[model samples]
Target: MKFLSAAALAAGLCLGLGATQAQAAQKALLIGAGEYPYLPPKAQLSGPANDVRAMTQFLEGYWGFSKSDIRILVDGDASKQKILNAIQSWLPGATQPGDRVIIYYSGHGSQIPDTSGDEEDGKDETFVPTDFGRNGDQASDMLSDDEIGRALNMLKGREVILIADSCHSGTINRDIVPGLAKDGIDARPRYLPFSGSSTFFADARDVEPLAREVDTHLNLSAALPHQLAWETNGSGIFTQTLIQGLSSGQADQNGNGRITTAELLNFMRPKTEAWCQGVEQCRELQFTPNVSPRNEAFVLQPVRPAEPVQTVTGDSSEDVSDVLPERERDKIAVRILPGAMHEIGDEVQFQLTSELDGYLTLLDLTAEGKLVLLFPTDEDRAAGKTGKIRANSTLTVPDPSYGFSFVAEAPAGNGKLLAIVTQDRVDLEDLLAANGTFEPIDDKMGFIKEISGRLNTVWTGDTTNRSVSWAAGYKEYEIRP
Candidate 1:
């Protein structure tokens, strides 16, 4: 029972940046516009709602951002005034020097004539509010690049992360353009064009972004100017993928307990591109994110590495008996081939030898801090192999006939392999991330809690008299790029 605490800690890689933010914590302004009163129904988007909702839940739930600090302006609330107020007022007022500031916008992005001459293309990229161009007021309605630059300037010299899932600039872009929705896929571009009303007017302003070192500022543009940002299944592709990478610890490349700015960019680009080619492919449009300050980097999320843990051990000659304490009854033998540190795509194997005869459960704590059941996978069960392991017998994971091999993947970080010998079979179906291999659980704490509770239930009654006994051993390793 005491050993499971270490397993829980291995899974619950909590972030210090999230927990202890008292005054200089994270603050965000989320803006999403799904409906535009001035635009036609075809211009109406179905993604912003999902975008803002997912972000809010992740920020508050996983990142430990205070709900009050995260100002959400969705749908009707995402008017020009509200977004400006949140950006220029609420966010600036709530932020401190070391605080992390996030400005995420999801909706229609289009180009208005460059009233500001700084744009090289002679067009200013702008995001439309829900009531954009209403009352023939495009100047006050649209969120232009110049306007965005000005707003971001107020947050200068701070840790700022700006993600605009709405495309900036042209209706016809070379990078990733919006066209007719793909056959049978409800993919839509989050870009709206100036419809009907021809007289487009705007106040001239300077085009200047946050002038800061790369470490303090990270800018992510979903699609370059004249390009189209895509969304499908009622969510923005960029936004959904970004949230997944950040939440699942996929961006914590090197598994170093921290996610760096470079890691984030590297993680997002390949993952998003892969997702675009998946089932219900995203328009087949080439996906690209424009990131600036190519060299310098900073930690995006600060997660803790598990402290060294002690496992109960006994000699192989010891017999399983009620007189001996559970910890002293059995020594778990576990080994991994091809060394500890591995690069992506390297195939790995595990060898487990237990001193007692019992059901064996092998678990892997991924470099991304996800718990996976490596033993008793569906293939192992289907092959008619039970979970039991006899004393002095060796068990090889993925016995070749099971038809699967363990291959290393990205988000390189510290990884742990655990072997537990139990008196009774522990049911883990509820905590299972998926069938065959597992998916990373989003709520790690809840997952840990369930595991601990289940272990308690399985190992019930007094310690001395209890026939149930379990011993666990784990090996920690690292994965590099």
Candidate 2:
């Protein structure tokens, strides 16, 4: 009798452990659609598949999600029915209380008239499915935000994370024309009617409403609300940044050796913006990543032992400019005008003066991490605007004659301006190819990488031997609301 009782006790303990393990299981569903069969060839994208693959690898490598537990649907396999079924039926049915669930979607996002009247904006946001029809049957083909909300509502007991790397419209900058050379290469997201068939507008709007339904949601918008999201080299700037943040340990902002959902979003936001705007090869588009989280912060990755910190000290009295050879430093001087607090809508300007004839280029790094080319306007070049500034002459940038100006806007914070003065004409054709042509800067990484390399080369030593003797100066300022 005693032996039988002990055996029963052991069986109960084993069953309890099995149940705990089942409850702790983590599951993920990744969906990406780059090839839209029903849409035009221009609508086809190359980033979605790669985005899914990258996220899957991150989940398996860092998040401890098993390969078998993570389901993937990409390109041809990602249909509306399949997506809906996975979200509404499979995920909720498979996951229980205390379990973690992740759903990631990378593809084109669109908007249609709101039939359910649930959207405050009078338009329903949607993810473009593989079989989305151009003319009709949008109701059945596209996955609406409302449908996603409903599906998420079913998984209220579990910890859920939602990520979307797409935009609903290109209305963010309606006044600004899209594409290079008027070819409309920068197409807006597809728009469909709420019902049968009608015209649609590709405008941008906030994704926070849909995010409210989930425990946590992160949106990697290609552009700000109403702006167009861009693709380059068949991958998304947002996705690439996301992968880097998670994989590189840069997202561990608190140095806690773990990345939380909030930390991940915060890390990716600036990087995505910088990459989209800074790279010369990337289409110059506005991208801002958004996040919505509940009261509690969820850990995206397990905690590991913190790495050792290394600290280095430098002389406080020494000037950074002292590092440069005296000859280079004396050749150029730059300053910002109205050296006072500037509010939004104020015109900010840079003043550059040189001691010798040289080419000049100015670049702005905004508080949001966007890089803007500020000098060598196309109009200036066409009108024989030479970089050659007579010794002791000061040139006020955006000379009003050029009919261009830079105004401060939201994301008010400290920003910087860099002036690069070179003795010889710098070949900036690749960097400025689309300048003044209304083509969005496409290669942001390329621009940042090349400019950084140039800056390092010019600043490291005396350039007396080089054909291009260069000097650079920067000004930091605040943009107030």
Name the best candidate (by lDDT).
1
For each candidate in the order shown, give its overall lDDT on alpha carbons.
0.60, 0.57
Q: Which stretches of candidate 2 lie over 4 Å from their true place?
A: 1-23, 134-139, 170-207, 213-224, 278-285, 294-298, 302-481
Per-residue lDDT tens digits for candidate 2, residues 1-481, read 0000001111211122111122255788999888878765656777789889888878777666677778899988898888888887888778764456778888877666667877666776778888887545556578877777777767654556577777655353322232222232332332222334364444445545446433333333344555445555666667778778888899888875556657877887787666545433234445666655332144444211122212112211113233333344546667766663567677666678888666777665543334556666566678677656666788887677767665556656555555667765555655664554432235544564444333322111221111135565545566677
Q: For residue 75, what is the lDDT in candidate 2?
A: 85
Per-residue error (Å), model 1, residue 443: 37
What local lDDT score does residue 172 receive in model 1, on the 0 to 100 scale?
46
Q: RMSDs, each prediction? A: 20.3, 25.7
- Candidate 1 lDDT over 113-198, as tens digits, reads 66757655456667788988677746546877677767765764345767778765343432223334545556777766664245
